[model samples]
Target: MTDGASRRLLTTRRSVLCGGLGTVAASAIGMPMGAPAVHAAGRVVKISMQRSSVLFTVLKVRGTLAERLAPLGFEPSWHLFTSVIEPMNAGAVDIHADVADAVPIFTQSAGAPLTFYARERGAPSAEAIIVPADSPIRTVADLRGRTVGVSRGSGSHYVLAAALKRSGLSFADIKPAYLQAPEGAAAFEKGSIDAWSIWDPFLAFAEAKRPVRTVADGTGLTSYHRYYLVNDRFVAEHPEVVSAVYEALSEAGRWVKANPEAAVALLAPVWGDLPPAVVAAANARRSYTVEPVERAQLGEQQDIADVFLEAKLIPRRIDATDVKIFRPSTVKG
Candidate 1:
């Protein structure tokens, strides 16, 4: 059979299977219909977004994805999650945008059926390890034996590891407080942690709200390429929807790059009315261009996986290319 016919057959089989599953779940729950029944025709595509994700936030705020998908007979559902891997593993979302490269590596290592559909160019300076302006921690070396706040398994974790390795230090040299971004921000303000390693908007917000110095950033250390991922089943069942999302995001990325002021204006409300200057600063450090995921572009991911394995952050080593990659034009049907 041709690839297009094969995909259609697979989709049909999946739809029937999902319908049965929905009936079974509803019966078990003593309900007439279940969650999957709500999407009997699979018209709704759930998108999980992180607050700090610039391109996704821009797309969400402007309702561009909905506008793009409407004509394609798809509805876009937006949901917020603290991190990308959580909703994906829980089966709560179909597509998740702006996950850090390290996140997928860890998720893949955990044996989740996740696949990459798109990627952003590296924004090395988009994340940083910062200290209060009046603090005595003057250098990366000074971090040794000090408490450092970082969200464990996050992009910032990889950045901290790389930065420390470049400075001839290791994870064992400092006390790691595995706090979320908001918690880390609070800790940083209270002087409970010596420094906080974090990404943009949070980094930008901190800098704008107080005096902080960049002890080091991802530059010369890690690539900081964010990725968009979807459930493996979603790709097999809805390639066209995936393609539409990719095109919509790519277009939004371009729009943000060309219209910084408008981008800031649209995003400020979602960010709790962050100063336009802060948002602009965060946007400046990011590379908003989106492209297809390719094995050739994943060398940094291998390094990141190795770092996590060495640090015992992940259970095992992972081949970064082992997961599926959805190429946009390859959707024959």
Candidate 2:
């Protein structure tokens, strides 16, 4: 989008309270997540969610988070975000439901006061580099000099870069058309771009509805974890609330994995009215196991940071492990 389009969308971002579960608005927001039961009436904890985050979307739609927090002395205010980096930096949101692992590296480079709270396990097959069914591109190397659509600073960004490297190529080999999923889908369909680096359910939607072939997925290139982040100030101010939210999110992940059919039914409408089968296909590629963020798990994060830096995507080098990790009171230090 152009600067004007972004500004307009940002101004029109959707925000809701607990009761407005199924509401869809002009645009979305994304941010990170805790606190205790003090029943502080109007104390609203602002949250941001990306549309692709199915488990978090389900949690929001269930409307049970408000009930869970009311006793802890707070109410819930939810915002749907396309990206949480700007919102978190501007303090527009307290908690970001989930974002691809690569996103935080970019946010960190920009010096956002964010902390990692939780993450979904690696699901390598969740994202991929796709081509038109009859395109001449057969391998990652064939992408050389071709135009590839990708979201800047997204997990798929790293996936494409890594896959290219493994094929003895570099990110500069291709012309990157930095487009968000919706625009990327349109461009791909119109043959304006040679290939697209994207994640599910968008990936699923394309496969189920369009003539595209998966050239490469993250299988050997990336693990594709989705991270939950919170503003550092928010974590310090509401420790108990963070703890409650972590617990609730962890349980939501378990429930989604345990009940696939119900998950599809609940997510289909919110995901732009995609068929239940498409939603199911997308969910199948996700590892919705939410757990506390640990330093050991961030090795890939450092790799991602280094890759983006080497590719000139980020301005400077960063130690991805430098950010704060939010550990609930129940978790050991």
Candidate 3:
């Protein structure tokens, strides 16, 4: 049994960023997103995040998982968030559930020092820059000096950083409003924000339901990916647990891919008036594959860090590899 002290160590150390292993790797093989073991007997695991589609498992499935995992003493805790990263730094949540783009910045950001753990094995999480259908912000370049809303370090934040750079603009080129996804979506609808930098299904939701324009996506920015992360201490003390968590995520990713409409239906109740049209559009693009973080992707992230350094989005440069902790073979089914 991992004592309280040991758990705390995991909280601080094995965190996600160096390719966050699912907001950080959870465990087991072919078991499907951290489904509680058939026999619950071990430790109590707490997963926290905003009730968003991306952080799907922790928010939606962890409770049922707790039941199945009872034999392993696996318990479940679901924490809510308007912003994903806050839970990690405060040490209030075991996993800093968020999009992959946020991973690099979370690890390399000047304020925090951490050992990143796990990440989703898939294409980058979805994102886009949205304007009202009636608005004149037709392209990325047109967004210059306009109020662009996004949750900093979230996928949209990264997308905006790269998109702005690609369009011959800097972060200074737009009016940055740091708001949560839901808030940003509402602000976008009310015309409170000129444009929204956000990821699906929010992007799809806004476009289809709110009549917004999508000027870009993750592929557009190339660095806006989804991720799973854990503190470094968790990785060292509970490698088995981490692997188990990853296995479950792999299954969930597969499930999501296979049943896009089901996934959307599952999410709509939580999204608060989000349009199924948007969810459907977003679902067509999500990928579900569990693999190691690839090099090109890392390069994109590195580029983001460098650009941020030049633009002062972040205070300093950080080597993306400095805090990686992944070992797939160590997973226990």
Number of clashing pairs per prediction, in order: 0, 24, 63
| TM match of model 1 to true structure | 0.85
Q: Rank the candidates by lDDT, best first.
A: 2, 1, 3
The order of the candidates by TM-score, greatest first, is 2, 1, 3
Among these predictions, the greatest lDDT belongs to: 2
lDDT of each: 0.77, 0.79, 0.59
Which tens-of-lDDT digit does each residue in 1-333 have in candidate 2? 567765543343322211112232324344222112224486888877766767667767686677778888887776766555677667778887588988998889989988888888989899999998999898999999999999877899999988888898897788999887666777777789999999987788778777788999999878899998899999999988888888888888889989999999887655656678888998899989888898987999999888888888899999998889988885665
lDDT of 1 at 122: 88
Model 1: per-residue Cα lDDT over 13-124, one tens digit each: 3432232111111111121111111222337877776656677767665767767777777776666555555556666678875787678877887777877889998898
Candidate 1: where are CA atoms >4 Å away?
A: 1-42, 330-333
Worst 10 residues of 3 by lDDT: 22-31
Better of 1 and 2 by lDDT: 2
lDDT of 2 at 58: 73
Question: How well is each residue in 1-333 modelled by candidate 3, as lDDT tens digits?
Answer: 247655543442243211111122221111122222233456666665543435344225434345444555565555545555555565555555544655457655744434444455444446677788888889999998899898776666777888888889987788999986666766776788898887765666666655666777667456445566666666667666666666666667777777777777765534443456666676676665554444445666676677667777677777764556565444443
